[model samples]
Target: MTSTPTTRNPPTSTASSLLSVEGLRVAFPGRRGAPAARAVDGVDLDIGRGEIVALVGESGCGKTTLARCLLGLVPPTAGRVTFDGAPLPRSARALKAYRRRAQLVLQDPSGSLNPRHTVYDVVAEGLRIHGHAGDERTAVAEALSRAGLRPPERFFLRYPHELSGGQRQRVVIAGALVLEPELLVADEPVASLDASVRGEILALLLRLRTELGLSALVVTHDLGLAWNIADRVAVMYLGRIVETGAVEQVLTAPRHPYTQALLSVLPEAPGAPVVLSGEPPDPSHVTAGCRFHVRCQILAGGEAERAGVADACRHRELEILRGGDAAQVACHWARAEQPAAGTGDAAVGRRPN
Candidate 1:
């Protein structure tokens, strides 16, 4: 059962956003007469300069795909990504330069690091590639220090196999830091470390943002992590952001049925767990209307029936609707309650399939 939830003041961010993604979509072509798989579909997001935004969702919901697109590791099938007012460059040379300004930290340090390369070599590799290796030793040492590995010289000669899990992860972070990137897209940065080490790594990330003025987009399924660090939260479901707002606002008073169901499972939440009826819909075979209606408790509990919108819930597509000053939710019932906040009357209208 969930516990009572206490309200916290909403997180505030004054910095201007540096990364903007508009209507991003990524589709993998299928084989043997199957339909294409849509990994990321019509996602819109923004990360403020010097801010930390958490991308929270279940597995296969496209959090990592969205992060990879921002890093230019995966080309989008549609939409555009802009950094600091300019679109992502298409040429290899220009893209390479862009990469140096935005680095990625993978989830598994053991798999991402080279067993053959020492800590110093791993960190200095980026510098060498970017022609900034005039003082390789000094650069590597500084990066290690910044990543919370003190007495950087002591770790310089140690290889991946010789270090602890946490230390190896630090080395991976140091490699990203060597480039002095403005944005860091970390995919589950602490998922592989020990419980004791997780806080240390998260603390290191917070410190980096504080001391270096870095912006980050952390992709994780852990809502606790979002509460612990993010200035804002974006909730993804079936390849779209169904809810987004200040971390506290979204977590404490979630508006969408999907977001509410997720929060209801938290140990400290003040109700019984909202057990979803079935697995998430397959990306290649998404439903016609509200993708979440099949598993939504609110709809099943008679919200749609009471409003005479049950038929619409099963046949009409829903769009993200704004509410109050800082929340957005995509649900027919939510839209009906706050009609003035969304678009025309058609915003909640039914579409026959």
Candidate 2:
């Protein structure tokens, strides 16, 4: 997205991430017979230095809330978010510093940019807030130019309403970049844009990542989009991470049932889509054994089919392995006969657990 190219800068060591999370949990209040809603229940994730990790799941699965917790915008009832080996504190001073190092690009571009402010003011706000004393003229111009609003001078004085949707969105990106964050948490930044513009923006985010040497956590429900940009993919289910691995591995050979269902529906490689039946179970009313058991096609038969086994046994013999390892299905029989790593065949060809 740039003509006069600039060399990418490596991230400062002080801003790098270490083991980022462990068993994160968040809950809302409940009453009567209803239990408190646990939006994020025991989620474990880590986004290392210079990594692009995508967190994909259905709506209301706590992806956004998890992002909020990561940024310290919301307090976590359980778990910890660490940066560069240090735990993040809920204190205002710690949070302010965290805000500078890690920034969030909201879902709605239009809602993010101020209607009253000129483009220059919108991009300049971060610098002003952070007590930056550099020449405002040069910083604003550079940020806008880097975002591809070239000869940035022409666009500086225009209001948000004057620019096209794409341009306005870029303005929001420029504003975020001006602060020069080490990590960016983009919460479905392209979900609201036109189909044509979506790719353009995705390209922009990727180019910025390469040129700026920035690490990112891209949150979206679209598996296709995650495949396109993320170096690694982490699939979330009912607020927990069900699968994670390199983009090629997780997308092509999913280990988790939820992950399998998601990839099966993708329009990848221009094939007919794999249609799925039933919606995700309600969080409050999630079933015993596994949250997805009700809709899962891997249920075991009752006493007549298998006499010593429980009437309903959860296939829990699977284990997480590195990408290119055997097809690590979360089903008991599949794990018992786990295939050799990189076998390119199913551990147990799609069958009932």
Candidate 3:
């Protein structure tokens, strides 16, 4: 499980970023006097024009909440989200205009599509709402064609129940495409489809980016999907980004303890999977200092003692720090050379006895 430090190439400048989120936070009030649940805690992110960035994490890590914030579907407790160098729209009229440029592709096509509506109606609904319905037929057919449903008119009058799972998903994408959006925030876009269908949908997304020059923020728990399509990867833990870098670098040689543990478990991983001992921490009552310290193999294995940073790992809050040329890791000991095999009892990158 040993890995060397690697450099990360930063994304384009803020002015050039198609979408930017700074210090974003979202919290829900807790019940019974408990602390508020912080779904997204101080996340900062940027997506360049035509870039596909995958937000990867386990369920409940707040990837969806972060996406919602970017979509203006949920209001953030704090922080700012911007598009094309301007703050998100506030008034109803302005927001409507903003939404036309940024659309969402949901995870479940079956649940998202109205069973009663024809495909034409589903795709044209956005055009009608945005005042582009005058040429609805043309726009609907074009969008459906762009989504890989060639000869789109043939399916125009078909209902959701009549389409294959893949075609239904394409209809959902067609609905988003009808708006001619510049940015698409797709939340687990392929999770519900068959494995065979998953590749088709992903290829469509990439084609849209190449042909239409669209940028996207895809949220998912599957690291393989990120490797397949995303240009960059942001690994989320709890509500914060713990590691982010170019997809090849982050997936091949992750820097964060959490990232390493995750990759170690992949089927073709180099070593026996590194298994952490506890469940992920609750967002409502996040621990102080490094949120992952309680389960970190390096700290648990006493590598921190060797580095003389054990105290810092338990008390001092660590910021997202540069670990290599292109990678940023949020850990006090990330830069330390990997501990020699059998160095500590931490089980950081070792199989269970």
- Taking the candidates one at a time, how many backbone clashes does each contain? 2, 0, 5
Give the true-structure RMSD of model 3.
Answer: 6.7
Clashes of 1: 2
Candidate 2: where is the Cα deviation over 4 Å?
Answer: 1-19, 31-33, 269-276, 300-353
lDDT (10s digit) by residue, model 3, range 1-353: 22231222344444678888877889999999999999998787888888888899988889999998898889899888889989997777898899999999999999999999999999999998988846779999999999999899899999999999999999999999999999999999999999899888988998898899898999999888888888788899999888876788788877678888888887768888888897888999888788788989988989877987788888876653221123466666774554323533231221111
Q: Evaluated with lDDT, which candidate comes out highest? A: 3
Task: State the lDDT of candidate 2 residue by residue for 8-102, as single tens digits.
Answer: 23222223544377667888767886887888877656776666778898888889999989889888988777876789878998788778788
Give lDDT per model, in order: 0.81, 0.71, 0.82
User: Model 3: runs farther than 4 Å from truth?
Assistant: 1-11, 320-326, 338-353
**Model 1 lDDT per residue over 1-353, tens place:** 22222232234432356888877889988899799888887777778788788899989998999999998889999988889879988788998999899999999999999899988999999998988946889999999999988999999898899999999899999999999999999999999989889878988888898889888999998887788778788989988887777787678877778888888888888879889898899889878778788888878999877877777778887763221224566677777654524445443322221
Q: At residue 235, what lDDT does model 1 achieve? A: 89
Residue 99, model 2, lDDT: 82
- The CA lDDT at 40 in model 2 is 82
Pairs that clash in candidate 3 = 7-325, 7-326, 8-325, 8-326, 301-346
